[model samples]
Target: MNNELTFVSWNVNGLRACVTKGFLDHFHSYDADFFCLQEIKLQEGQIELDLGPEYKLFWNYAQKKGYSGTAIFTKHEPISVHYGIEDNEEPEGRIITLEYESFFLITVYTPNSKRDLSRLDYRLEWEQRFASYVTELKSKKAVIICGDLNVAHLDIDVKNAKSNIGNSGFTAEERACMSALQKQGFVDSFRHLYPELEDRFTWWSFMAKVRERNIGWRIDYFLVSEQLQNHIIEATIEDHVMGSDHCPVTLKLAIDVS
Candidate 1:
């Protein structure tokens, strides 16, 4: 039985591209039990990643080439695995669920709210359905969700809260959806550990100096069922490890993995 489980999640923007930008270097250095990724932007046989035989690979690719996608590299063999949140079955490769002895691990690349809010309605629908799906699984076993969630739920979660008001990631609707998830006995692992901390963010704009100046939004997350709260060793943002517009977030859990 394993005494601790370490998970790392990142929105790589594009996995194939990230390979040239220190992804492999950082990936090897972290050596997490489960390393989750979003926006792979590739399909089966499109690219080869040798994460070694020790790690089992799971990939979900978008119907449209070079679009949204997600993947997970896990060292421990899971009992079973699934793609998408049964009901959502999103065309854009989004969710990957791995069922383990102690918990269910899901990684998602949530749909973005277009600049013009054109996809906001669809995004809201997904939020509700996704939340419902995970909550349902939590009723049976602990659920650990990690990935680019695409919504910054609170004022403190965004660097420029006032300026970003009504913006896609900061909109009231998206925030409310996130609130509903938390209200249902799920915990935002990072915020649960570091409430009142400020300026800590996961995603940054590519606009000049935005990331350098640390002006960003905490859109990515690692949320776990409330019952796993005490098992958490720590939840953190690996902002210093760079490659994608968003940094990696890690969660360490003191749990059995037998």
Candidate 2:
């Protein structure tokens, strides 16, 4: 009950590809209490992994094969778990909620609005539903929501904010949705820790040497309920350890639940 929990969330882009590209090595090295993954891109029985005996794996794959998916590997078994939002209408395997003794952990692979922002309206609706889901979980315990949110909430998050204002991840509307969530008593753990830092991005594009040049967006986040802010010891973007377009972001908390 006096344990300090370390949680890591990563958008692996495609889990099968990532597994071939040092995903297991990173997983063993980090040894996080809870490891959340997004964009798995595979259905059940698509891949086999031996994640060691200590950790338990929970998966939520999309009904459509080789599409959106999310998973969780936790050292501590959850009291209960849920897939997608409570509404159950959106069943793209985009959300996984784990109920622990002291906290509720939610890992999400937010819908991309696309380059032309054609899916902007749907993305906005998803954001609203996601916020409502988080609020509902907060009623039970402290909440930690993580993974690729697919939005750059501030100018400091992306390389060319002025030019990318209306672009998919950097649009004003998407940012507003994120802001609304934070305003509703949630803390962006990374931003709260390093308020003035810049150029620390999570998701990079595969085209045009974007990753090498570090021209990326910090669309991924580890957000917690306001009351749990005090428990946070550190929040980090593991940009160096990469296998996908998106690297992992970690949160360390000195929670002493008894």
Q: So what's the TM-score on candidate 2? A: 0.97
lDDT of residue 143 for candidate 1: 91
Q: Across residues 1-258, which tens digit of lDDT does each residue of candidate 2 receive?
A: 457999999999889999999999999999999999999999989899999999999999988788889999998878888888964655689999888888899999999999888999999988888888899889878999999999999999998789888899888899999999998889999989999899999988889989999998999999999988988899999999879999999999988433
TM-score of 1: 0.97
lDDT of 2 at 16: 97
lDDT of each: 0.91, 0.90
TM-score versus the correct structure, for each prediction: 0.97, 0.97
* Clash-forming residue pairs, model 2: none
Report the C-alpha displacement of residue 149, candidate 2, in angstroms. 0.3
